[model samples]
Target: MIKTIGFGIGLVRFANAACTSGDGLEGVCRTRRECARIGGTGSGRCVNGIAVCCVVQKYCGDVTTSNSTYFANPNFPNLYNGGTICTFTIRKLSDDICQARIDFIAFTLAQPDANGLCATDGLTITGGASTVPTICGDNAGQHIYVDFNGNSTIQLNIFTGIAANSRVWNFKVSQIGCDCPTRAPSGCLMYYTTLMGTVRSFNYGTTGNAAMTRQLANQNYGVCIAMQPGYCSINWAQTAGDLYSFTVTGDSPTAVTTGTAGTNAVIGALCTTDFVVIPNPTFTGATPGAANVDRFCGNAFQPLTTNSKPFVLTVVNDANEVGDIGNRGFSLDFTQQRCNNVPVIG
Candidate 1:
């Protein structure tokens, strides 16, 4: 609702010509000329001559101690639009030793579309002190609960994919040992055993085991990938397009600026903060050394399903952040081939 002009002035309105609607919002515009004549309650961007004013979810912020409450994506229970990016920073309450525990009342993420593993649309949690795994998956709509250990703060990074399959998440923010409500009818996040994996997303300070690290080498190039949960592989043979190579080309937004989950090109390399630590923060398939821990923002991707240990890997989302419940959405398919593997020969 930004209007630089005075109301009721003799102004020629061009924001939206009455032909086709964009974003279903009344004041949306589809052209630069229309965008010049400000309209709508959000920022304006013209896509393919169609201007859409995206309204980011307002509830997300640097949240402190909260008793118990509910929050969700910009339009909860409804499909969120694509090309959305939101980051939420959370802090521990009043110097408390125990970090806040997050209980995902309802968590639903879009699965990989026809293009392949959703390398763009995802939710990444970078913990402050206590680490939580990044949660990005479409596991048939599951309930997840996690404790942030003793992390001083945590950051929640969420991005929605194309409008086709975005999901709304509901959550409760409470202390580590508070008396929360009963679990949802389906089931709690009791599934704690992370077995072998084929596709995984990693953050800083993660580690890998031998089974995952066996596929690392000086062979293939690293690609920036932001994989979601739905693209896990179990009985993968030496498939034509399945190989394990690891590398993190850039940082958050920069890594995904150009080539994306579905784009058919390579994104430029732009890292931030610092190059990911080696050995300990182990997402195997990438840097050679210790066991491969994960395939995350800064790491490379190497196909681990070898002829010998073909089906021994298990996909794991290194947990962290995990606090935000409301965000517009993420945009995957930004590019087509995001660190795709070459043909493997046993």
Candidate 2:
């Protein structure tokens, strides 16, 4: 896969002098002055400045190789008479691990005149469809397509009113590739746990305690929780002595249950009485099945107590399989406070 080798940073400052050559424009717009403002080093530099000119060249590579050129001026109705150049590099860390499968490269730009308004446009790679401009509500950006199949070079361009000084662009390169194995799996149901308060003791049925239970629940893609145990009990603080008030979070169709704490069980230990939830197990893919649990514990939720809480669960496949075979395993740890209220569980 394409890993970042390095990035080139360049800066340009606007010229101090005002534009003198005005063909018909009204404002104090000067091609020379504007060019200087873009931090051009010499005369005859493009109007937007050298940075744009240079990036375009770098992205396009040799002019003889690609039919593209930078826009001569910002005032033309034909904004992009000749193509502009954009360039960047990607490095491959391993020869056999993965290869770059980049779909496209996105470029975000700042608004014109700082009224907080922005716009976006996209350029095609090979023979893809052109993307429409998205109004970024005072902050717009653009995306340019690139072919990263075997090459790491990116080339494309856009036209805009963004001044070089006030202009800002961000690049995001996306790819789907395999990762090399970094370690061997542990035999125990690989407990990928995240705790909030503290792991003090392993008692069950106490005030301010939490626990997690799993059952043979069947979900659309996988299975849902068959039964949630501690939920009903948690609400009892508001409705004193009401057994009906006890609610488990939700039930799984396949019905997963908790086993007693031991070597094979998924257990939770608390350092204090303030409830602490054990981290939810992660899977490697969208669906949970025999293959999903192959690398981790499958038969039990070990540490069940009033102090264990289950937040979010995710599954990720192995790092080296083709298609979706490598996509098994719960790779995400969603116990952090910020991930608690997501609408989807996967």
Candidate 3:
């Protein structure tokens, strides 16, 4: 097929002796026999030189979220393998008006011909009698927003042929109010932090889509964060008389450098070489192309203060920066706050 690659998580070494920071892994030297001996438990498969030892990921089942939240393909930013079927159900929360919004930033599937039909690996979304058309093939980079009104549950089922594979897709989903005001996204890729926990990215900006996250990424990424940081925001909405403010906080591999940059109230110090986070208020955002956004990086944060949901935040691998960006992955964590009816799509 024209499309194929079980890519994601750059393998530092191969199955047998592919990866080794030094002289061979000392034990796993390019053979199933040697790998099995060292693994000390059972036999091993030397696929592409690396020993198959790690626990394989399971693809199936239900995903319940608090109120508004985000979700993605089982192993996004990586190619989906063959003959695998998985289903995910995003359960609804109480504040949700029985409505859900799914904003797809990137989606791709396998197809053999030029026709619109997807005869290979693909994914489909359905809610009761309503079902999103099965999507496949180069539908990689998109700005699609789906609204499930009058529905209680949203489900996704994906599968690949006996010998088919597909690229990755990423999206943000949240509960919506019966009616609310809305605005167009200033940027393409979006992240909606809710009252739940943290939401991670499939990659970063580069690999999946650039216009939204910032720098582009190469395909061989892992559950690892994108080495290239990008932009994102939070959404806080008020319902009835309930209201709350949130402080954004996160952590990286300590491998990310906190370089020297300008000190604006928005983004913290500049760490062009190290990863940095830039925060901005909704009414006024960091101007495009000018490194003026507030930059914050290092092991911890000062808790970028926010009084509302959907606050725009940016993570960038400054073109001027360099060094051990490592996996570029970071853990986005924030204290729980009460939020709801925040729009995930238009």
Please give the TM-score that candidate 2 achieves against the real structure: 0.20
Q: Write candidate 3's Cα lDDT for 114-160 as tens digits.
A: 22234566677677333344555444333333344456677877777
Instruction: Estimate the overall C-alpha local distance difference test score of candidate 3.
Output: 0.38
Best lDDT goes to which candidate? 3
Question: Between candidates 2 and 3, which one is better according to lDDT?
Answer: 3
Question: What would the TM-scores of all predictions be?
Answer: 0.34, 0.20, 0.34
* Model 1 Cα shift for residue 152 (angstroms): 2.8
Which lDDT tens digits does candidate 1 get at residues 1-346? 1322223655333333222234342223334433333221334453333344432122445344333323456666675665677666555554533444444655556543222223446666676332333344343222233344456666677787666655666554544443333321111122222232222222111222212221111111111222223322222111123111222232222333343332211112232211221122222233332343322223223223222211122222211112211110111111112123543222
Cα lDDT, all candidates: 0.34, 0.23, 0.38
Worst 10 residues of 3 by lDDT: 238-247
Regions more than 4 Å wrong, model 2: 1-85, 89-108, 111-159, 162-165, 170-177, 181-346
Which of the two, 1 or 2, has more TM-score? 1
What TM value does model 1 have? Answer: 0.34
lDDT of 2 at 325: 12
Which residues of candidate 1, in runs, are more than 4 Å off? Answer: 1-58, 62-64, 113-116, 128-133, 139-150, 177-346
Q: RMSD (Cα, Å) of candidate 2? A: 20.9
For candidate 2, the lDDT comes to 0.23
